[model samples]
Target: MPSTSQIRNDRTAVAAWTLSVSHPLMTLLVALWLLLFANLPFWRTVWQGVEGWDNGNPLFLLSLPLFALCWLYLLLSLLAWGRLTKPVLGAVLLVSAAASYFMHSYGIVIDYSMLTNVLQTDSGEAMELFSGRLVGWLLAVGVLPVLLLSRLQAPRRRWSRELRVKLVSMLLALACLVGIAMSQYQSYASLLRNHREVRLLLTPSNLLAAVHGYVRRELRAPQALQVIGGDAHRIAHVGAAIKPRLTILLVGETARAANFSLNGYARQTNPQLAKAGVISFSHVSSCGTATAVSVPCMFLEVGHDHYDESMARNREGLLDVLQRAGVKVLWRDNNSGCKGACDRVPSEDVSHLNVAALCGDGECHDEVLLSGLQDYLDRLTDDAVVVLHMKGSHGPAYFKRYPAAFARFAPVCRSSELDQCSTEAIVNAYDNSLVYTDHVLAQTVELLKRNGQRFDTAMLYVSDHGESLGEGGIYLHGLPYAMAPEEQTHIPMLLWLSPGMERHANLQAHCLEGLEDRALSHDNLFHSVLGLMAVQTAVYQPERDLFRQCLAPRQAFEGRAGASGAIN
Candidate 1:
């Protein structure tokens, strides 16, 4: 019935439709490859333990899905311009590699040396990055199917039997993707998989459909910032009653509670603190496992499960409450990176300032920050609160950071290459860092004594989280709470009330008589600061305030076994 030219065009149209449908399937498969590599918290470290790739650049939590979408977009955009070919493949890989390399070098840099070490061919860094067993597995598992699919599908194919089979196959592949996404514990509480990520994967028209849902929700939802509970703004500051001129709170980074000599660790890494009469709270626990989650949560009135809820009630934070009540709060950090906790607080990341002569250029010692505090205290009012975020044990290169003075015992490993070093060397290098951390605490106490003439002072110490020193071959922190050992979450804490500050604030009596002995947490730090200043917010509970009162002496370390991995 139709002319010859018309029949020829109709077949072309069907083929285009089949190819268009199959591109999404291709993108989904690649997305699965990237996601599997990154879901583990200690990705490169985990691979290294298996004698796998020495380097693995993790995709940001939202970046892997973006990567997949970009690949699909390239195919569609180029296909729109014309057909696919070898040059197009080359261009796509070039663009993707450029983007990935940039992110690898600068994305939050939990271990900057890990990247440098693995990428250096002379350093075997390149070998580690490329030859990791996981990467090999990915190539074997993912590349073969992809090569076959590319061979079978033509850009201008029709809806033939083979194409229908491909369509069904694509859906099956996507289902597997969904299953993998569902398998991760981080995804258990989230189903949307991030809206931006989903939109990125869809076609432009489909993306608009996805956005409409977002817009509808935005229109219907109430303001998230509105107060749902206690009025942090109206709360009263307890006042300048505590006697000591100032209080220093040292929040240590990654010093595990179990490893401290004060905790009965046979390692004797805590010699300086033991001599200085430091009473380490052997059983202190961290509220969360990661810095981004832990630091903000520690400063809020909300519990971990509802940290976002607290963000609404008060964006003001602990410093705000302290300032309103008239205690000057100053934060100086030489430690692991700061999360948003420092957003509204007066703070410094002195990690780059090599103040401790213990290590060379660019290596910051936590004690160096401690040495500088007396000058900072002198400038502040007598009734002040100073918080030092200490870089106690941020690791991988643990052996190189501390000075030989603190290297108490060792035929220690001298490099970050934990797998190549003996277990004792790994343990020695790590324990020496702990020894130095204790010294830093003692120096802080002596600084308070030197400034004792102006006002009474006290010092309280807490660690953000603990570290994993080669336990199960995972050599650092940030594992999912479910898989983390007690060493990685159990942390040390202490409180030494200066004679004057305690007597002046009437907290001296409170410190000596009001509180009972019991295990405490960084969760208590938020309310305790309020109680110390005497903030009159409804959220202030004595039972929850470590400074005001304690329940009983700390008992055995507690651990929760379920997926939440909450420590009791």
Candidate 2:
């Protein structure tokens, strides 16, 4: 026998609970929690700011509420799409969770370049990234919330009314956010400037921005290819007899100059290259800090500032120009594809070759790039160029890059989980890969010298980009260029020229060696190649060419040229 007042109160309480359970506000709260929890790495970093308060200033506290409101704006705005909210938010959570796991585990950041690298990754690289850790994180943080959200029922409301409510709520949230930011502009600016990596690692936001940029740049139809150097042709000195020329452009992957002995590293990482008498350029930098950017940009006439992937993709590259000039060009790849740099030239993938000595289950040793290469070389005619794109020192499984015999450095990091290994172990593994690279380069030079009798030969080895080995708690490469550390940009470059090739270009070996310490970058690659092969084009800028100073004075030829037969 309950009293009337108590009975009425109980009914009211039940109605309130029912309203909350079925309301859009309740859904927004759930979405906010899902976003924050899914991005654990971001929250962890934010927690650091909490612990690092400046004398317990209350203004610093505003960041928390502002951040929550900002997320509310994002979530509610997304949810206003009616039934699509569940699917869209669920997908965002899953992707953000996966990105968080990798960023936390591998010390990587989510950026446009990283997104491009992810989308462009081959099945082999993708397979290597599969792990139980990823599965566990996805299930715990990504899938469970998605299932819950999918099961939850939406509030019954007219579409117009719902849209109006969503718009008002978003406006209120944004107003609060802007007010807070404006009030603490100095603090915010200082914090962001000092910790730039924070923006790149901020999950959900970083992921969204990266996805948007990728879609805008890569998914859309590209512009038509712009032909460059269409009037390219080679000219010969009258008295200097034409000799068959072979230049090997050895593109190394992830080799930093700081780790090479020839560049004054305390370790003897270049024992073999040192013995072979190759001149190592001590101050060379790459155009970009990632393979997807550097490989193609290195072969383009564009500099770092003006380098655009869209433009690079649409324009003919150095290889195309050389091929148009009637030079025989071949590209041999042991890593990933050439990223369209070799599309207009003859190219081969040696990673799939059947040489048991040089290949494993899915990938081949760099040595495989040399197998049957001499046959290809023998078949080429005069003024030839070959590019050997080696899979050198690509991480975090650096131990797999070299054979056991080349594992001179002991107690190396054997696991792909680099964080679990000690720093010494990681360096040992990375240095061992370099030692093997030294061996490979030495072997390449030996092979070139051996072919000197048939044709004047030269070899130029330059890494696409450098690697970061646990510097500033960063492992691997691909930080934004402005924020990139020296390790990611400063690369190793080595050159070897036979006496005959040197004389043909009117360059002395000692004179070229004297310029080893001069500052150079991937910007020099295009013009240098043209200079080496004697390809004269309207686009050839002598100021940009590394070998231009070494060449004898030229009386510019004014006529179309004919290809001389193979020099004998």
Candidate 3:
């Protein structure tokens, strides 16, 4: 053992050897380190995206890193103060490491929507995202840099001198950035324009921008709730003689259309739904690539093309409109809580229910949405709309979505760390979840059929968004809408109408079957529901309603009771 005096001397030497630098110098070095190591995803994407790179100008390739370094250095200079230097850079490094891992491991980009999804993710879902590989990645890239940063010290200088140095450094970085841009303006412009998502791959910059955007949006002044469809009133087609209509809007999660056998998948993913007399719309697309955006957008009359998140949050949606029209509206969710779409309506999140068979590991399967559903339906005596939001195929733990009995697909991926599993195993796990969803849908139809004597019932199932099961190396969802693949946008949709609903709405099953190939999307959801429920409002565009053309002329129902002013 060394003596106390010797130990003190050794500590003093170690302290003296600690790297010390000016704030500007520290920022520059950190920026360079980040550009090289923290942006592998960015570099990889750029390398692959560059058209004809083998024959392309070498100068263009050189300019890419030069521009990135200058950009990062200039941005780093904003917070490169004496005390804030290490802490800020350390935080950036840690965040960049996490962002880098996700971007590289799963081909996702950090965007406003993705950031929103992350912020809104529940503890159970967040837990599923945690993996050993992620911890290792963070240790290697995030924790190590932060640890190194702790040893380094930025020696304080005169305030005026420090400011001057930082300003000069920023100017130099800006100049280099400008010079690089000028040298390859066309190439840079083409690259950005063609692959707009590339910008969202930049490590710390992407994370910072996304967080900034989210904060700005969230901190903005609250808007007054805009109540729409004030003139809404449900028209009775059969007077008091016929049973009331009960429309169950079954919203599915992460169910891609490509995997749905009803949409022509080779695997029988939707076996139960296939035999349940449902009309599966093969060409249905989703409003957005994630539940946070898609759920609210689908409820808005404006549709995805014109969707404004702020506007949607402050406005009355389809459910509110239905309620205003005297249709009892209730939203029961097994997934995330309706993404605020059901805020104004009667909503229940049954995900945390402690039912023995359906609930375990802090989550209930999609079947839990059906629990106590019959009792609720039995109590309903009026025209009503019930939204059953199923946790259908929500991943990366696809196996957990279904019970073991539903795990008919052999050799399924049992772990949430999806990348560790073979693609075949992942698909098997996902398909099994869909198989469970199928059973749930079939059970819903059976329940509707059982209640047909008292109510004319229908079930319309549409997924909020689709999932990406390792397609193009992209796993999970929430790539920006423009860059999302068919697996992330194309969703499975189907309709099951009871015999009474078929006659009451004057909808022929064969007509709907023929219209299966008709291109539809979440845009049609708002108006189509209005048309089906016989709710008349200015927002109910007959042109957009899928059922409008399929319905017989008003003249056909003219002889019926309460038929006047009913068919809008």
Candidate 4:
């Protein structure tokens, strides 16, 4: 026979346990835990996510960790203060909601709309932001607890056994969570192997680079833009252009050409591009898995082989060569910076995922770039080179970025939540995004065609890197270099040049000639761009150049170079 107080305490514990279990709190907490934990390995990802990471965003870092503990504090309050009054809890909920809304809606560069923009899948930034698809969780974890505690009429309930059981369950859950986390940590290297793009956004090394770049703020052009080694203006003298101001290089973000319909992914993802008569390269490969490396590597003098070795020392590159050769260079980017490629030239970050573009709506669309593109074209100088970096296919929250209009395809062939949705649903969602990318390319080409009278126009489109949507259990890019897949390394490359434009540059002959659709890698970009622009720079690497008749044999099976571009 237990004493009266002990019996009361046991009953009390049981009652408390029931409240926790029955309420949506436990489940909501679990969801949040999984969401956060799945991403915990990359601290900055979730860190940069919550709006407080940036100095501009002005969210107190301490406040976030403190706010995270609020639920526990609230539970304690319930235990001590008994049931909170309806009006009081309601006000508290309202205030919290308002604050959350304000924080989420304002001053943040990312949101859920990009995820919804699946129809326009080429918008990679949307995909990255969309990876946060913890929907319904907001209501359950956020509003329900407050509502229930305040609304329930009873002041007391016996919860002894229930409490003990609940505590044990939570502990087990935490243990399982720990086990899972540990497994992820153990598999971290392997996981990164498949998701090679992780180096781009998450690695400490990358963070160090970003921090250093920020400290240096080296968008400062290290060299002056002057005509280099030639008549600079005449394309024919250098040997490619019949007229100046005709070439366009649209660098896509996070687009894996393999995923594009152009590469035979079984989805009509590239329908619009196909309809627009765009020439899709079947076996084009990106040199590096990350924009940080790939973008610069493609534009650098030393290719990926010596990029890391000599990037810091060697200052001159394609843009420098082009600028010195007198072609105008303007970068219209939606991703981060031009990663130092535009150091000497001009650049604009046109990310629609920015706070100003998506105020309160929480639905930043990738098409926003398209809206402002006309103005960009109009601003182009006669002999100008423009680079449009679209946010293509970046993601984890694959479903929320696209609007209802772009959702033409169905069954979502695959889902972002991996196991929750069918593989088809996930693929469908991803393909839908690819579809949007096709549209973007089409629109871009049309603009060039429409502006043919103003200048001879050509568009070169290539993705920064590829993506992994539930392939090998990964739903995003950022795979480690050592274990990146053919799917991840292989990407779509397209050249949409007007017949006149191609002929002017004398590249029309090779337009469809040698692009036999085999393996051509980003290593070829350095020289090809020079050939396209006819920029007469000594720094151009002719051996790796795509224009080389021998290399263009179309029988190239694989990129001879490895991740760092060694023979390995």
Q: What would the TM-score be for candidate 4 when compared with the true structure? A: 0.56
- lDDT agreement with native, every candidate: 0.55, 0.80, 0.87, 0.55
Candidate 4 at 95: error in angstroms?
Answer: 29
Q: Count of backbone clashes for each model?
A: 31, 0, 0, 67
Ten residues in a row with the worst lDDT in model 4? 107-116
lDDT of 2 at 280: 89
Candidate 1: where are CA atoms >4 Å away?
A: 1-166, 172-244, 309-314, 354-359, 506-517, 550-568
C-alpha lDDT of candidate 2 relative to the true structure: 0.80
With candidate 4 superimposed using the best TM-score fit, by how many Å does residue 282's alpha carbon deviate from the native?
1.3
Clashing pairs in 2: none
**What shift in Å separates residue 151 of candidate 2 from its native position after superposition?**
4.4
Model 3 residue 431 lDDT score: 92
Candidate 3 lDDT, 305-346, residue by residue in tens: 899889657988999999988899999988878876899989
Report the C-alpha lDDT of model 4 over 344-453, residue by residue, as the tens digit: 78777666445564312444545555566677667775576777776566554555445556776786633344546666777677677777777777887887888887
lDDT tens digits by residue: candidate 1, 1-568: 9999999999888656443334444444443433343223223322333234331323223434443344444333333222343234333333333223322222211222222222221322222223344344444444443444454343555547545655564455456445545554353233233322222222222223434544564355454432222333222212345343477888777788877887789878877677765556666677665554566667766655566523522365666656555567777866544454555557776666645464345556776676556667768753577888866776656765577778887788765445557878878888888888888888888887887777776778888878776665556665445455787678888767666655444444444432323666777888777655444455666677765543122210110112133111
Candidate 2 lDDT tens digits, 319-409: 9989888889999999888987998899998889999887886898898888998888777667889999999998878988998899989
